[model samples]
Target: MAVNAHAASARTATARQPRLRIMVLGLRGVIDVQGGIETHARRLYPLLARLGCDVEIVQRSAYYPRERRRRGWRRITLTYLWSPRTRIAETAVHTLLGVLYAAVKRPDVLHLHAIGPALLAPLARLFGLRVVVTHHCADYEREKWGPLAKAVLRAGERLGIAFAHWPIVVSPVLKETVETRYGIDATLIPNGAPMATPRRTRHTLRRFDLQPWRYVLCVARLVPEKRQHDLIAAFQAARPPGWKLVFVGEIEQGDGYCQELIAQAARDATIVLAGYQSGVALHELYTHAGLFVLPSAVEGHPIALLEAAVYEVPLLASAIPANLALPLPRNRYFPVGDAKALARQLEVMTQGTAATTAERRALHAAIRANYSWRKAAELTSSVYRNVARGGWQHG
Candidate 1:
C-alpha cells in the first residue's frame, strides 16, 4: 500500500498540475493564538498556496468574530463557520458545518487537522471529496476529557484511521502506535519551526521585570497534561535565587485547573503568568529566556520545543518518549512528573554556565535540517496529488 501510494505521488509530481483545491477543517482559527493545530495550519497552508494549491481553512466563528475576521491569510482563504462556545461541542459542531461547507464547495481534497474533526471522514468521502487526516495526538489521553469524551475521541481516531485516504502522523512515536494498534502504515510528517530568530527587545521583558537569561520559559496552553503545576512545584522546591519562572499561555474558560495554577503562581512574586502572546512579544520571550522547559506529560510533536531548538536556548524537559525523541543530550532529561528530579535539574541549570557557542550552532543546524516547513509542505502536496489521482480511494 505504501509503495503504491509513493508511486502515485511520484507520477502526480511529474505531471503538469492544476490548482489543487483543498478545504481544511479542525482548527479553532488561525493567525492569532499558538495552539499546535492552529500554528501548523497557519505555517503549512501558506507554503501550500505557494506550491500552487488553492487552500481554504474553516475557522470557528465563535473564536474568530465575523466583524473582525479577514478574508484570508497569505494565499489561503478563511471561511468562518458557527459552533457552540463550549469545549466539548466546539470542534465537533464546527467540523460538521465545515464538512457540509466542503460538500457545497466540492473541493478536490478535504484536509482534517485533528482526530475530533476527522470523525466526519466518512461523510466527507461520501461527498466525493478525498480525505487526509493529520493525527496530532491521542486526545483521549488528555486529563481534561471525561469518560464520554474519551470514548468519542477514541472512536474518532478509529474512524479517521479507517476512513481517511491518507493519514499523517506527526511523530515517530505516533506512527509506531498507529501501526502497532491499527495495522495502518500512516505517513510520517513531523512539525516544523522557523529558523529566523526574533529581534531581541527589552520592551516585553521590561513589562514583566525580567532580565535576559535570568528566567525559565514554558509556552503551552494552561492545561492539565502540560504539568505547569509540577513545574511550579519544582521551581519552588529549587528556590533558584535571582531567577524567575514564566508561563506564556492562556487558560480556557471555566478550566478549574487554570485557577489552581493561578493560585499557585500567586504564592511567589518570581512566578509570572504572562498569558497568551504571539508575534514579536512571543518571539522576544523565546529569544531572551535563559532556559526553555517543556514539562508536558503528553505531546504529538511539540512546536514549542522545536522553536526552542531553533533559538538554541538551553532545554530541560521531561523524559517522555516523545520529548526524548528529539536530538538533545541525555543530561537534559528528567523523569516525568518527578518534581524533585526536576528541581535538582533546575538548580543545576540556573547555577551552571550556558551552552557553548559551538553547541548552540550545532543544535540550530540539526533542528533546521530535521524539521523544515518546506519539506513538510512538499511531502504533504505529494500526498494531496496522490489522493487526487484516486490512489487510496475505496481501496
Candidate 2:
C-alpha cells in the first residue's frame, strides 16, 4: 500500500477504524534466519499488515543478500540501510540511518525493537515521528558487553524510556524493572510462540546421524551467558545410552567460546554441533527430540523454550527468574549453572517418567492460547492508533 494512501485513509477513518503506517527498526534483517528479535519481527509485521496497517521494516544492508535487497515480504516493505559490521557500531549506526529514513518517509509510528537501537528514539522523535520502543532485554547485563558498551546500553534504555511515546516490554520482570528504575509505566507485551507442524523429511536427522526421539536439543547462540558449557557437562555426566546431544546455533564472530564448545563436543561422538538452522531443519529437530533444554543464565522470554513447548517436547531449563516465570512445572527446573543437578534431572527425563502424553497435549494447548501473534499484532496496532490520535499517555 502506498504511504500517501494509507495516511489519507487513516485521516478519513472513524476513531474505531484508524489505519496506521508503521516503520520498524532495530532488527538484523528478517525473512531468512533465527535470531530472537529478528524472528519476532518476521512473524509480527505480516500479522500487523493483516490488521489494516501499512508496515515497513528497516533492515541492515550487510545482512541481506543483493537479490533480496529492495524487495517486500508479506506486504511489508523492506528498506535496507548500511551500517558497520562491528557489534558496538552495528545497531547504533543502522538505527541512525533508519531514523533518517523514517524522517523522510514520515510514518505514523516508528517502532524500535531492542534497547540498542532505541538509543535513537529521541532523534526519531525530534524529526516529528511518534516513537514506540520495545525493551527486548536489559542488554547491559549480558556478559558479552564491556564496561563502556554496558554504559552505553544503559544510557540507551534511559533515553528510550524517557523519550518514546510508548514503551513495551516482553517480560513482566523487565516491566517491573523499568517501572522501578525509570518510573515509567510501560505496556506488557510478551513474545508469542506459534505451534509448528512436524516436518515429514528426516534429512536433518540423517545428516547428523541422529535418530527419532534419541537426542537432546538446544537452540541458542553459543554465548557465555547461555551456558552451553554447563549443558554439555550435564549431558556428559548423565551419559544416557544411545542418545545424542545436539547444539543448533552459530557462535558469535571472534568469540572463542564456540571453539571451547567444539572441543568439548569432540570428546564424545554422541554430541553433534549442527550450527545454525531454521524452517524445516529446525522444526524437525524440535519435533522428534527426546528432550529440549534451555540452560541460559539469562534470557528475555526465550523464544526457543516457547518453541519447544509448542512442539510438546519435554523441557529442562535453568531456574533463572526469566525461566521460572514461564508456565512450567517446578520439577522441570534445575539450579542455574549446576551441572550435577541438571544431570539428575536429565536422567529422570530420559527414563520416560517425564510429562505424560495427555499432560503434554494440555501444556501445548495452554502455550498456544497464551502466546498468540495475532493478539500481539492487535495490541501493537492499538498502540499505534493511540499514538496517532495523540491520546497515549505514560502513567
Candidate 3:
C-alpha cells in the first residue's frame, strides 16, 4: 500500500472506533531499554497513541527512571509498579503485580509481550480481563536460561496461546510453530527498524577512536545466544587488516559472558567493547561501519539486522530461520555459530564491495517498503478493537 492509502485507512478506522484503554505487561521499560521487546514497544506505543488508543504500559520499578516512571511517554501512561529485580523473579513478579493492577482497574484489553509475561495469561483470563499476547520470541531457546527456566518459558508460550483472547506472533516462523503445536492461527506482525538519518558527521567515530569504514560492528546484548565469541574468533582468524572488531551493546550485572569479552578486549587492542549507545551515536556506528554481523544462534526477528539494512551496511548473519526470513544474497549467510565458515565469508566480503550506491538505495527502499512500524501499529489497533469487542472466537 502507498503512504496515502495507509493514512486514509487509519483515519477511517480510528474515526469511528471507540478509544481503546490498553494496559501492557512484559519488559523493564521502553525509555532507552536495550532489549528487542523494549525496542518493539518504544516504536509501537507512540503510533498507537496517534491512532487514539489510551495506552498505559506497566513498568518494573527497578529499571525505569524514577522521576519519569509515572510521568508517561508520548501520550501513553506508564505506571511504575514495585518489582524485585532479581534475575529469576523479575518478570514473573512484575507481571503478577501488573495483572493484579489490571484486574483492579480493568482496561479494554491487557496486552502481554513475550512468553515470560504471557505465563500469567490464564490468571488474567480468570479475572475476566481480555488478554492479548505478542509472542516476540521463544525465550526457551536463549542460551542463558537453565532447564527449569526453559521448561517454564515453554509452558508459558503454551498457556498464552491457549488462553489469550488473541495471540500475535512476530515472525512467520513463530506463527507456523504455534499453529502446528497449538492448532491456532496467530496474527503475524514482523518487527521494524527506523529509517537512518543521513550521516554527515564523524563525531561518534572520533569519540570511539574509530575510523570510518575500518570497523566490523555487531550491536546486540552480550548474551551467550548472541554468539559474540564466534564472531570474535572469526575476526581473529580472518584478521582483516586495518579493520577493528567492535561490539556495541550492554549486559547485566556481573555477566560472565561480558567478563570474558572484557578480558579478550584487554589482550587484543583491535577488539573494542563500546558498551550501549542510543540516538545519534548508534546511528553513526551503523552508518559508518565497514560491515555488520549477526552471529546469533536464534532470533524471532532481529531489529539489529533491520537497522543495518536500513543503514545500507553489508550484512552477514547466521543461517538461522529468523535471520533468513529477510531476503539476502546466499553469500551473506554462514552456518550458525561456525567461526571457520564466518572467517572464510568475512575474507570474501571484506576484500570486496560492501555495497554499491544502487544496491544501498535498493535495500533502503525495500526495507522502508516491507517492514513498517506504522503498519504494525495500525494492525495492532484493529486487533485491539476486535478483542475488546469480543470479535474473534479464540481458544
Ranking by lDDT: 3, 1, 2
Candidate 3, lDDT over the whole model: 0.88
Q: What is the alpha-carbon lDDT of model 1 when measured against the actual structure?
A: 0.86
- Native-to-model Cα distance after best TM-score fit, residue 171 in candidate 2, in Å: 1.2
Error of 3 at 209 (Å): 0.7
Instruction: List the global CA lDDT of all models.
Output: 0.86, 0.85, 0.88
lDDT value for model 2:
0.85
Writing each residue's lDDT as its tens digit, candidate 3 over 285-311 gives: 987998999999979999999889888
For residues 199-255, write the lDDT of model 2, one tens digit per residue: 868999999999988899999988888899898899999998889999998755666
RMSD of each: 2.3, 4.3, 2.4
TM-score, cand. 2: 0.93
Tell me, by TM-score, which candidate is best. Answer: 3
- Give a tens-digit lDDT track for model 1, residues 232-305: 99999998889999999976666799888888778789999999988888889988999998999888898898
- How big is the positional error of residue 67 in model 2, measured in Å on the Cα after superposition? 3.4
Listed per model in order, the count of residue pairs whose N, CA or C atoms clash below 3 Å is 0, 0, 0
**Model 2 superposed RMSD (Cα):** 4.3
Residue 188's C-alpha lDDT in candidate 2? 79
- List pairs with backbone clashes in candidate 2: none
